[model samples]
Target: MCGGEQGCIETVKAALQGGVACIQLRAPGWKKRRLLELANALLALTRPAKVPFLLDDEVDVALACGADGVHVGQRDLPVQTVRDLMGPGALIGLSASNSAQIQQADVAAADYLGVGPVFATQTKTDAAPVLSPEGLATLKALTEKPIVAIGGINHANIGVVAATGVSAAAVVSAICGQPNPLASTQQLAAAWQAGVK
Candidate 1:
């Protein structure tokens, strides 16, 4: 999701400064060399900040860049396969959109579960149906693994997301294309905190 009006690195730096808990690099169509370059640069920032950096669907690039791990979708590599490749120390994340997917997921292998399009999202053209806060809560009850709510999360609705007792929220457009990613991230973080309270 780089190559926006503002560069991805700068946006990441701002989000880190704004207290983003983790960073997932999710550039879908870029070439491997370019993806590796961005991953390395992002690692430079995330590593020093003690933030976990993850690549989306690019295990080779992640390994090359020494990223913390990779996030895989259902159609991507299997969770056990990813764990086997990344080994025990690497943090693996899996996306499961509904109860059936969640039940079928190999929770033992993944460090966490990314569940959503909790609302309508334009970020992913093929994103799942909207889960809403209630759907997220229902999905949460289905698994013991930490849930990171994804899709359509923004400052306006992040409070309800946080109030769902999810372990985290994965935001894209809210910060990525914004005028001030740092300020936007700060507001989202504050909203998440307020929602948690």
Candidate 2:
């Protein structure tokens, strides 16, 4: 579940009930202390479920809370740096917006890549250009690293994104912003099952 909204921990619990494969803690504009608290609560939830718990762009938070990993973007620290900080077995996901970015990323250091604002999104005000399904497919072909399609992904279009063979779909408003996060997650999971990969 994506954060930056009220009652995010509750939303995360509901989404977990619907069988989300993983959970990422991301609340923009919040203080580190609050983020750490949220991450700790999520760790409590995710550990029992055996779902990976990831922190977005905060290596310190991830390290402090012992998160499964951290997801970093192009402007953030390099993937290698994060790997060195987290050491082996801790996951690292890097953003790869284009072929060049994909080629340049240290795949051996990163466990996955968060690629694209696959559709137009309002959650991330500064999201990259929409990749559509075709564009997503193009990017997916550029790398062997597991690709998690982020930005604007939701139940309505998750199937199409899945058809592009993205390794996973990351959402914000789709599940986290839903009144019924469990239902949203169930729908998204169903759509994901239809993907070629």
Candidate 3:
């Protein structure tokens, strides 16, 4: 969800109202003060909803805001280091886009694996090569940790991604810039439920 702070907050509020299972703050370019402010605002919403709030690649802000945990990519801090800093109870997520990455991942330290670009994506310009649904499932077979499929996931394809047995689908454009994030989330949630069935 990349946008001005207020826009991002509103989108998050709508998604939360629409029952998103978790919230991850991913503001890579924002200054620390601004990021902290957004994290705190989001926490105010997520804590009450009982939804886990995770900061993406921003361990400092996450720790300062007392987020539920942090999600790190391959190049970010190592899983064990994050676990050590955030403590054992913190929920750590690691991104794994392919077999080698998955094979090399510190699975025991990460609470879950964010696997994808399930299709091509524009959200993260530097995202790894696309991992089609087949690739995602192949990786899934290698780990028992929960899988959250990310990158280019939207309403049209979420059902297919969900059908692959991923624990959850992480979307950016599908909800963030939609005319009605709440409705978009509701529809996608329904699609995911149907696919999982």
Compose the digit string of candidate 1's lDDT tens values, residues 116-148: 999999999999899899999999999999999
Question: Clashing residue pairs, candidate 3?
Answer: none
How far is each candidate from the true structure, as Cα RMSD in Å?
A: 1.4, 1.8, 1.1
Candidate 2: TM-score?
0.94
lDDT for each of the candidates?
0.91, 0.85, 0.90
Stretches of candidate 1 off by over 4 Å are 1-6
Cα lDDT tens digits, model 3, 1-197, are 54687898898899999989999988777799999998999899999999999999989999999999999999899998999999999999999988887878476799999998899988788989898998899999998889999988888889999899889999888999789999999999998888884
Stretch of 10 with least lDDT, candidate 2: 1-10
Q: Model 3 segments beyond 4 Å from truth?
A: none
Best by lDDT: 1
Task: Report the poorest 10 consecutive residues by lDDT, candidate 1.
Answer: 1-10
